[model samples]
Target: MSELSLKVLAAGSLRAVWQPLMTSFTLQSGIEVDTRFGPAGLLRESIEQGERPDLFASANIAHPQRLKALGLASRVEVFTRNRLCLTARKELLAAQPSWLALLGNRALKVGTSTPLADPSGDYTWQLFDTLERHHAGLGEYLQQSSLKLVGGPASQSVPNGELAAAWLIRGGQCDLFVGYASYARRLRLCKDLAVIDIPENYNIQADYAFAQCYEAANPLSDFLLSTAAQEILFREGFARNL
Candidate 1:
């Protein structure tokens, strides 16, 4: 039997989880997987420009829908959910961090996936906006500050989970890195970094979705939405449905 080779363009936050998966999938099906990691938006742009890939998985369902609308993708399906989490140096959390505590610090510095390039960032922006409505004065500081947080998070694509965690543990730089709870958990950075839950009223849930591109040549695209794929996502801390 001939081995299948598929290209999987996935979210930047998935670096930790996706690493150990490709080889295992290949061993099971004799499929050779080529993975490209990036902010979800960048990946969508690549697909639009005709970089043929067998499968597309995004941290948000909207991108897959955009691809489907562009006729570059088909069989789009939502298979997972993720929520925002805050990463802080262990000492910071030990101080008893809270939503109110975030702004009071005066020392609080924050980082998130790039909103222009990633959905997680976009959601963070909405989170801030909702916070502003409730707190009023607090959002003013963000507006006046350099952060000027317009639409969302950032996407330095921090190399890997360990490095991102290191950023927090070492402190002095971005004091908080807000992103997928799963990534924060995977890094175990929360062991030293704290997770400030976004209040349910303001917090947003991320719906992850996947689709087969029109130019794809294999069935792995279909396999991605199967019960098997849901199992993998579920095990990884992503809810199978929103």
Candidate 2:
């Protein structure tokens, strides 16, 4: 039988989870997969611009739903869940970090993904909105204070598939980054980085969704939702969809 070749455009944050799964899938199915990793919104734009990949895996449900609305995808399915967290240099924070204090501190540089271009950014905005309910004007303050470091019109280019949040902190571009908890865990492996969990009340769940852009069925899509795949996602710090 001829080997099958498939194209997959996935969220950049899925690198840690997807790479191993893809390798296992190729070995078992004799499929050759070509993958592109980036901010979900940017990849969605590419698809709208006529780039057709076999599958689209987004960091949030909204992006895949947008594709479904545009007739680019037949359906959207929730694959995994994530939560927002704060990532910063260990030396930049006190012994016990508080989200409120960190965000309200004007002297510390805060970074977030570009809103509308990355679901992480969208979730961060949602978090800000939630914060507004607790403290008047705080939401606007955070929005204005945060540096849009990735996944936007003017985002800086990152090399070697490094995440924008990690790159920014490593280069001293920003003192802290608000991003996915899974990403924070990945970064926490670095000696100098600390991952702080957001309070439950302020945390926004990031629901990842995926769709097959083309009519053809891809086994990998089904595989992603299987028990084996969910296990990998869980091990990588993603919360499984119940």
| Candidate lDDT (C-alpha), each | 0.66, 0.85
In model 1, which range of ten residues has the least summed lDDT?
146-155
Kindly provide the TM-score of model 2 when superposed on the true structure, using C-alpha atoms: 0.92
Cα deviation at 21, candidate 1, in Å, is 4.4
lDDT of 1 at 53: 73
- Which residue runs does candidate 2 get wrong by more than 4 Å? 1-3, 161-163
Best model number under lDDT: 2
Model 1 has a clash total of: 10
lDDT of 1: 0.66
Scored against the true structure, residue 175 in model 2 reaches a CA lDDT of: 86
How many collisions per candidate?
Answer: 10, 0
